[model samples]
Target: MRRRGGARRAPAAKEGGGAPSRPPAPPQREKLAVSTPFFAVIGLGAFSAWRGMFSLDTVRVLNAYAFLIAAPAMVLRVMSREPVAALWNGLFFAAMALLGVAVLACGILLFRRLAGLPFPTAVSRSQCLVGGNFTFLGVPLMLAFMGDRAAAPIVIALIVDTALIVPLSIGLIEAGRGGGSPWRIGLRLVRGTLVNPFMLSILGGLALSLSGLVLPEPVDRFLLFLGSSAAPVGIFALGIAAFLWARSGDLQWRIVMPLVAGKLILHPLLTWFVLAVLLRLDPLWVQAGVLYAAVPIAANVFIISERFETGSRPIAVAIVISTALAALTYPFAIWAISG
Candidate 1:
């Protein structure tokens, strides 16, 4: 074909030295965003427990599905396609390391200078607040509000979970005084992360979206139907995790309440101020920040506790407690920025 003002554009280069002038587009992520006070309903349940309005059992189921089933499915679908280089690059690893370090470093500094609490208390509080329930609450909550635009923020959340959350939690698990293999622990961490159902499902959905492959009408309809269930399932799972977590005796109001305070209030505010005001991040990014902040402390906090036997019980209470309290704070945060 004759070129119009393009006098034979340079021949497409070969593989080793020069490739195509443009890099292939990154995969497009697709997500669901549904925003209604869905979480408010959850808050009500948690609140009921607090007020003796309803039993806490309702909350445990909500948390359970989100963590156990949905999250693993979503992650597998997503992580399966991760470019090998993307998985292995030192720079990416470093960023995650720094974020993880920042979590602990900030935790120590804050606890020492400001919290004036025990070392473990400071550490647990910061860790729970900074990291989030990305796969569980984050996916649905964003979809409820932002819909398909939910995809990008979900991506950011995943990166945060993989790079920041996983490493930090492992380090905390292995704290000092031994010859246990760090790599062994790291591998175990990676293994657990990779198996998250919601993560896998999101990845599957995103893959289809990026491949220019539309689900057949019936399939699409089914997915939509299933997708609609995302929030309720998540909330129920939250309820369950909460219920189970709540049963532990002598609930540490001193530690648990502070973690809730940090997760529900401070976390979102800091994210909004930084991402929205300071960085002028994309509006979607701001939304992601809000999602990150608004999410209750992760079930993983309890998981880490269970695994390493680090303060798991309190963290569990914190997750359940934070989520319920978040009902009040989440809406306000959204309202503040809705302008």
Candidate 2:
């Protein structure tokens, strides 16, 4: 009876073993493996661009498909499935976006005055400081890091940037150009936001969510199929566009250096402070906000400049440099958020 109470002994090591094996060094931490898919997509895009896998016209078509078809489907799928309570986060997203824009806009204004930039140039540059590549770069990166659950916060942030920040930038640029009635500008902003395919999809999704209507099985499956294509296609398109923009012309160090620094560093820091420290949002939300802030300036900056017939060269240079540098800065941003 006493012998039966003894504890079981561990298995003996092999004769040649000096000590028990130490679990393979915990798999070497897999530092780069986590980011492998993201960087792979980016590398493919770069190669595509360098090899001319897609022409300019073909690239535009691909972008349109991603934006209008694939991306909107993903947005709708996520938003429609999200609870109405989750949708309330849009207000916080809008607030954070507005705060980031205001902070950066002020900095840009001060820099513009000190540098003696023209009004149109100043406005365009300020827009670049605030606007981000949320859909193209931000969405894919977040999906890569956080998976499908990230879509909700990302979509909300996209809405805020597209609806509020974008219009404000456009209005400022328009105001700088000449005179326009405030009412007209406001109306245009509203109409533009409402009419956007991306925004419209989000609204439809919200409406469905609020209405408590479940998507039919066929519809749901269709959306999932389309949504699945958004990340790869959008990232590839971004790479191609970035390559073309970088080759557009010679870099202007004076303007580009500041723009890149502000976008990749200052914007994210301010966003993190506002969302994580001040508002105390969910960690995921804070991370999503900061990540969106850290992306390069949206391609819309150049389009808006062209539309308004304002400064385009500087904006293009800023986009190219910021995007290229982001290949480095984004990884750091991810690590910061993860840590």
Candidate 3:
């Protein structure tokens, strides 16, 4: 009788599967849903710019506000609240360093040998291969997808890009220019990195985290409020930038497409292999690394181009192309990673 009862119970459990529940939505779908609002705002901004509703000066002001004010606040809030030690993942750092070097080398070689770009121009463009729109787009996307778990990885990624990859790329750019010595280039990189608002915020947050000091309630609230404004404003600014570039004459698609392909596809593919396969890090780290890599070529690339007076149009066009294409590529990437 007992055996018969047990058999019946086992059959019942198997048939019902513990409890009735809806199959969870696909992770990729969930991410897309979260992303739609941000993209919508980007479209709105683009439309506005297309209609000539915003001037170039207005776009510049918006960019400044997002960069100097809103983004720094966001970074500080996240970095301050998290424990410093918990945020430092040695494996992630190593993966980032390896990936940066690989991307930089490959970009330079491809441009120099195949496209036959001048060496300095090639070096400047190579920075785009490693650089990403981490500040404006990446942070919002990460928060939407992974929540606070993303803070450490985001911090590490930014540090690698800003402090290491960007500096090295700029150093090479200077060296290629044939005037500045190695020591001068290194010093300038260090000084610029130190003064950057993003870096300053990171350092401030780190200090807060290390000291175990809670911010005063009012101050904390202020940071939170300002930080929350960053995503929409920054993304909108991106659209304005796209519109501005579109009106600036020839796009030079021949160069633009390759740079777009490198940013949206190659970087993420290599990052996944390194983090997910080679290092076998945690899934969150792997996802963060790849997705961040998959973000568009940064607006900063255009800034660098303008500063150096080289490749401005092509780089700007690549930025727009990569960003637009990311809407399709990013969902696919999420699906791949989840799978």
Point to the candidate with the largest lDDT.
Answer: 3
Local distance difference test, candidate 1? 0.56
TM-score for candidate 3, please give it: 0.89
Model 1 alpha-carbon drift over 4 Å, by segment: 1-37, 40-65, 71-101, 109-123, 175-179, 202-206, 240-248
**Model 3 over residues 106-131: C-alpha lDDT tens digits?**
89998999989877789778878879
lDDT over C-alpha atoms for residue 62 of model 1? 53
Rank list by TM-score: 3, 2, 1
Model 1: worst 10 consecutive residues (lDDT sum): 25-34
What is the number of residue pairs that collide in model 1?
A: 56
Where does candidate 3 have its weakest 10-residue lDDT segment?
A: 7-16
Question: What stretches of model 3 exceed 4 Å from their correct place?
Answer: 1-28
Q: What's model 1's lDDT at 142?
A: 62
Question: Candidate 2's residue-wise lDDT over 239-325, tens digit each?
Answer: 777677777767888877887788888889988888778767666677677788888887788878878877687788788788777
